[model samples]
Target: MARKPDTDKRIAVLGLGRFGGSLALELMRQRWEVIGVDANPAVVQGYADQLTHAAVANTTEETALRQLGITDLTHAVVGIGTDLEAGILTTSLLADLGVANIWAKAVSRQHARILERVGAHNVVLPEHEMGERVAHLVTGHILNFIEFEDDYALVKTRAPAEATDRTLADSELRTRYGVTVVSIKRPGENFTYATAGTTLYAGDILIVAGRTRDVEAFASLG
Candidate 1:
């Protein structure tokens, strides 16, 4: 959905890493006034002509960031990935400056835990998570899934061996596995529902829900 252009919403992105650069460009494409900052001279120069204002500055320096008026921005992202210390320092400074929303990137598990403890609103480890997803796909029998919270997950897994050739009511999946069959997708345009009196086929994909471990175990059933 296209957003109605709002010229007044100020957004700032610190660190011109690949992720930050893409985010700034996207915000600009949506007609938002964006301020992109980075300490790298080459990165600032490369995007100088692309953004509303691009500058080379130390984002972790509270004084420098305050002078940029980043506090006035509605949202900001601290996309420092290479240096864990810099990422944490920049995030801490942004929180101290009272930025309304702050999103940060983490390179490791410990790094993510620290960012959360330091008052960052959101933490992301995109590369690490993507690597896991890709590995799952490559190994096969791992249906598509997404983690919504630490414990719960929404997954689309292949029908378990016990569920094959069984109708929804006969499967007893909800009572046994504690997973709700949200939907079922068959070949072509066919789809079965939780209420559908349909028998499962060999290649059918079942969109299920439960704890993460439950989902993993079900996916392992060839």
Candidate 2:
């Protein structure tokens, strides 16, 4: 589905690292007016023509952020990947500026907790999230996986022959593996939510969700 345009949102992305740069561009592509910032002049210059606005400033400093009018932004992203202290400082400053939403990237659990305590509305651990998905893929059973929150995941796995010709209730999934079969995707068709009576078939893909451990166990079965 095409996402609704975010034309009304004035966004600021501090940190022009790989993730931050890409995120700012994507938001602009979705029609959001974005200010891309980075302490490195080279990075800022590279995106100058591509973004609505791009600047080189020390996002950790209050004065620099104020000068750029970042405090007036409705949303901001502190994507400092290597500088943890700067990331924390930027997040706190954004909160002080009363930005409605502040998102930051954290390298570790401790960093994530600090970001939250410092007033970040959301903290992301991209490495951990992507690593989990890649690990599942290497297992060769999981077709796709997404982590909505820590310790839980939504996974798509191929339906084995034995699992076919049976209703979801007969699968004993929740009772045995603690996963709920949420939907089924037949090849070349849209997703269909799985009901208790929904029959599974070979070659059908199942979307299941639950504790990560349980999801892993269930995927291992196929």
Candidate 3:
């Protein structure tokens, strides 16, 4: 895993809308030093004293951002839900100022593509990703799965009918399922693959890791 900086964890959030406000609150709750910015004075005042620093400024202007001293920060999140042009400009300014990580929330796929093009490290589509995960689980037997990275995932699925009544070694599931059998959760036991030689009774949930499509296909086999 890429380690975040060991120095002071400083985060700057632009736009004091609900998404930005909530993120600021959560970061403050974790004891992170946060600087929050918004174009509306009232919105900035709403989070006064809750965040490390709150200011009213238009982030689209490079001069205003420089004056706000936000360029010194190492991390920033652009949470503007509307006026994507402002978000893209602010993201570009942050990147120019050498912010190591910039997380920009996009309202649509086109917006996300533009943000990424503007040097944003990550473009977050919270609703889209959540919907995809929910739809996947609703349509398949996967209890839960987490996307670890672009090409990797961790998934937990109910043992398939064919997977029941067989030992892990007997199943050759790695070859068959094309997923690494990380572990198994029997009704009351957690078994690692090293010890998967034991019997797998029905209803045992198998925790596996692989590509998203592979994991989903294996999960649907139940």
lDDT of 3 at 24: 94
Q: State how far residue 109 of model 2 sits from its true place (Å).
A: 2.0
Reference-based TM-score of each model? 0.81, 0.90, 0.84
Best by lDDT: 2
For model 3, the superposed segments whose C-alpha errors exceed 4 Å read: 1-6, 148-152, 188-199
lDDT (Cα atoms) of all candidates against the true structure: 0.81, 0.87, 0.84
Worst 10 residues of 1 by lDDT: 1-10
Candidate 1's displacement at residue 160, Å, is: 3.7
lDDT of 3 by residue, 42-84 (tens): 9999899799999999999989888877777778999998888
- Compose the digit string of candidate 2's lDDT tens values, residues 74-102: 78899998999999999988888778778
Clashes of 3: 0
Which model scores highest in TM-score?
Answer: 2
Q: Local error of candidate 1 at 30, Å? A: 5.7
